[model samples]
Target chain A: MAFMIAQRAYIKLYLINKVEQRRGYGYQMLEELKEEFKPFGYVPPQSEIYRALHELVQEGVLYRTKQLKGNDPSVDFQEIVLYHFTDNGAEKAALYKKQVKTDLDRCIGMLHKAVADNFV
Target chain B: MAFMIAQRAYIKLYLINKVEQRRGYGYQMLEELKEEFKPFGYVPPQSEIYRALHELVQEGVLYRTKQLKGNDPSVDFQEIVLYHFTDNGAEKAALYKKQVKTDLDRCIGMLHKAVADNFV
Candidate 1:
């Protein structure tokens, strides 16, 4: 990919976009992104994905809530930390998505015009 | 712009694409690019654009030809240096353009799907 998007930055946007769609755990989001971007030849590394998620949390873009498994009232169950987008995170994610839309439209339009002018 | 392209790298691709479209001088291409990308809010700086062009020529992706203006074949005239895409440059530019088209289609599709799934 000659026009590769910055991986970490893209992952931040991706994280926010996914949480905006549906909140999930760090691992779940990573797997989802890998599957989503794999077809585009851009499945980011697992470590980088985790690092991005942690950074998002640290930067107050996301907050973690502890979820207990097995639905046992008395028994101690494994705790799963689910990531949720903050208000700011959601706002920024929407902005990022809009930016993506604008860029895609621009590039596609220019390329079409170029091809048409030259090829046709 | 949350998803900004790497400027230098992009300039390289942009230069090649422009020359492949039509050969022109360094200044002419810089002006052309400014106009081309201004609508996208991404007209690069003059220095960076020129630097990218120089680097491309140095890298053998482009070749320079000097053109003499004014009618007299033997008389002194202003010499204009034009940048042309080498065979490799044309090939690479075509590849870059194809890459851009692929990315545009992918991002647009994903964003459309995201919007449809979430908004619709």
Candidate 2:
């Protein structure tokens, strides 16, 4: 995460944004992120994703509910833990999204003008 | 720059891109960046700009030309040093621009999908 802070920040925002939309299991979220970021050529490490999820839960931005995994009706099987955002988590996610949008728009717009005005 | 690595990287790419496109003066580039980034609500500091410019020169990515200022013929006038990319500088700038474009497009595209798929 430290080595790839920029990517990490965006992933964080995307993760929280997803949680706010609907409840999600940790493994599912990681799988979804892997698929979503495939086009970007990034598959975030499993450990890093888990670390981020754990941090969010610790920060009280997310809550987890444990239930039986999938459709398997085995009492011996381990339960699945799904995550949901608190109200504060949702608010924070919205803010992070907005900030990313702002900075992206700004950087892209400025780069366009700088290249055009300076180079041309 | 440490606090805003994403923004800094973009700015560095933009600056190099501009230098490769046309010869420019340090002060002029700073002014242009300020105006261009105004929409994004960032005014990159003059010192930071100078530092970046100097670093590029030190790295042999840019060269400086000292010319007497203005059309007014006066020996008392101070010389203005303008910057331009060297052959290597132009090549480096092109590479940097390409990398920035790749990451930017990736980041922006993933963000759009993440927001749309999750938030919608």
Candidate 3:
């Protein structure tokens, strides 16, 4: 009931984008999300992005690797994140990506047909 | 380059939906994703979905709480996951949602404009 909504940038914003990008996780994924959001003309609140990511993990739609304690050697974020898709996550992201593409194609096709029937 | 591709049903589909719906995480989120995909005519591999989830945590994009032991008294999944978005994550998801809605609105408006311009 809740997850259902009109539609938002949130849709293809996260895991789905990563899958399409080949692969990514954590802050790197976040960076990618930002790039994706930019052309769309909005930058998701960093917090909200993190929240969605958090929710995904909680939902088991995503998986996290072991923690890095107080600080990781490489990144300053203090967390050693290694977000990944379970096979399930990958399959789902892929499936959704395909469907969205199909839907868009249909929408475009119908629009063009209507235009042709009426205008040209 | 990669993340910027055809808009898949996968977009406008994930955490953004959950956030727009209010909130959710974990296996529950997976269920939500599944429900979202069903109407589109495809189902993702469960393993893929899980893998995606795992990766998100690894990336630190999503947060995972303490894990339940091999077998918690309650569930059969052998994992107890509590996930929440970090502040940055929440902000980004919210921002992205607004932008997407705006894009869809613009697309809808243009379609109606053309129709009105052409018809009686």
> Which candidate achieves the best DockQ against the true structure?
2
| Steric overlap count per candidate | 0, 0, 77
Q: Return the lDDT, model 3, position A72.
A: 54
Clashing pairs in 1: none
Write the residue-wise lDDT of candidate 3 on A25-110 in tens digits.
Answer: 56677676567546545455667667766766665556778555456557654655766777688666556545544455444443
Instruction: Report the Cα lDDT for residue B43, model 2.
Output: 73
Worst 10 residues of 1 chain B by lDDT: B1-10
CA-based DockQ, model 3 = 0.02
TM-score of chain B of each: 0.63, 0.76, 0.49
Runs of candidate 1 exceeding 4 Å displacement: A1-10, A20-22, A51-61, A67-79, A85-120, B1-14, B20-22, B51-61, B67-79, B85-120
Docking class of 3: incorrect
Candidate 1 lDDT tens digits, A1-120: 123334565566667766776756766787887777565555568888788888878877788888776588479677877888786877766666575555445554544444454442
Residues B1-73, model 1: lDDT tens digits: 1133345755776677667667567777888878876655655788888888788788777888987765785
**Which is superior by lDDT, 1 or 2?**
2
Q: Rank the candidates by lDDT, best first.
A: 2, 1, 3
Tens digit of per-residue lDDT, candidate 2, span A3-112:
11255555666668667658477778888877766766777777777877787788777888988775766645778788898768777667766766655455455545
Question: Pick by lDDT: which candidate is best?
Answer: 2
